[model samples]
Target: MTTAPFEFFELHVLRATRISPGFARVTLGGAGLGRLASGGRDQRIKLFLPRPGQQEVAVPVGAGTEWWPAWQRMDADERAVMRTYTIREQRRAPDELDIDFALHGDTGPACSWALTARPGDPATVLGPVEEDNGGVDFRPPTDADSVLVCGDATALPAVAGILAALPPGMPARVWIDVEHAADRQELPTKADAEITWLCRDVPPGPGGPRGATVDGQPAGAKHPMLEAMRAAAVPGGAPYAWLAGEAGCVKALRRHLVNDRGVDRRRVTFTGYWRRGTSEDDLIRQAIAAAA
Candidate 1:
């Protein structure tokens, strides 16, 4: 059976505020939000921007396979460039709302736009749909065993969101990698989750940094993140593990957790949020192509 493509929402920034030194929260609202799926974590969305002086233009929405033709028809400069981002938070009441964007020195369009965003800015928004895991919602087993969650800055919001949403007294251990010590923020959660933040002084490598091991070893050296994760004892049993970040690092961590640690493949979820030398749009294109 074929699933119908989801609809897009034409929204405008109702407000934009800087939450941290390198993060911005933009709130969007419009009638189109009626189609958004509630509480979609780590879902990607499109934000259609108007060229310097253009008023309005048509932007493609819905599934990639069916939307490509309309997108192709537009002039290169006029077509909207889509970027994937996790839905940090959402509010469906008095209309609709979303918060996201990480400020990374203007390396990409989304970051560039977010750094300078203001109230009333026009940006067509779409989606709050299931992402890489195919809509699977795997929570840590209550009576079973241990839990491990690992990710970098791009995956922070989702990790944080998951942490905050966990049921009280749930046992899990989480590891997060960020650009600097200052980038570390409190992740409030009711679950009995132990979180460790890995901060690197060195700029992110070819791929975003997954952080050097505590002993100053290279990222791939013994799979630093995975090693740290392994050292921490899983209380319940063999814990369900989640790993997400740069393609290479995520793949390696996934391998270490499942192959070396003997974690069941079905109990682990790994995602390559981004790749080295590629923009979010490129990643989206690659995913769409692979899906096709």
Candidate 2:
């Protein structure tokens, strides 16, 4: 099987359907999809949005250092905006995949585009690349007795994916916080996983806005989802935890799980899927900076 550069992949929207009050499922089709690995639950892919009236977008083929010059040489109007999204579901036989977009108003490029996406629309698929460990490694070599997966609306697809892929009877717990009660959807999983949803009925909290409460208390004040997780007494033992969502919430959960609960750092995978008040590009930059 030959794998091409992420940028070489073409964009073809096969179908789009409303999955829920706040989510739209867009199915895309292309050749060689089966060859591309099915990114496990919570895995992300970058989408390159085409400019108006443009049929294709050029993607650099190699390292940033080798690709920057070519990227800079392109006209400003021809450049496509990049956004990250989760692989909600994938089917190989038909070479099709579905990505669920959270319809949280028109605040960003990808959200805005997805709001109006229709069949036959165009989009550039960027990555289904391997993780840092190389290839798919769902079972990490760790001694933890349980697993905790946490995230907000942005992380739901990943949470659902992880749940569906877990080995039958594996012990895990999932915590999800979304903008509203209607955002909750059925998760398919055979693992001994308990999922709790924390609904924030108010509009999304403004980025950088401190002291905003989800209900009558601060957003973190016994966040319903976290409280439920903490209260659950897994008789087996402490488990490795995976946390993702807005940068602040993820960071806070990491601190709570590690500093407060004394979870071993090696067993935890925490990611900031997005930031409250920053552009997707800025969020990526921030993540890179933090890792650096």
lDDT, each prediction: 0.67, 0.67
Residue runs of model 1 more than 4 Å from their true location after superposition? 1-5, 51-57, 61-65, 128-144, 201-224, 284-292
TM-score of each predicted structure versus truth:
0.79, 0.80
TM-score of 2: 0.80
Please state the error at residue 276 of candidate 2 in Å: 1.4
- Backbone clash count for every predicted candidate, in the order shown: 4, 2
List model 1 lDDT by residue over 1-292, tens digit each.
4553445677887888777766777888877676677454445555666655565636876555466556756676777756656667777676757666656554577776776767777777655443333333445455546667888877887887778766788787888776666667778888898777666654445554446533343343334566566565666666787788888888878787778777778787788877878776676567656766
| Alpha-carbon deviation at 8 in model 2, angstroms | 3.5
Candidate 2's residue-wise lDDT over 1-292, tens digit each? 4543333356678888777667778888876566556557666676777765676655654533344345545565777766777888878677787888877664576777776777778776666544432222234445666678887778788888889877788788777777666778999998888766666664446461222224322344445455555555543555777787777777777777778777777767877776677777676556556755
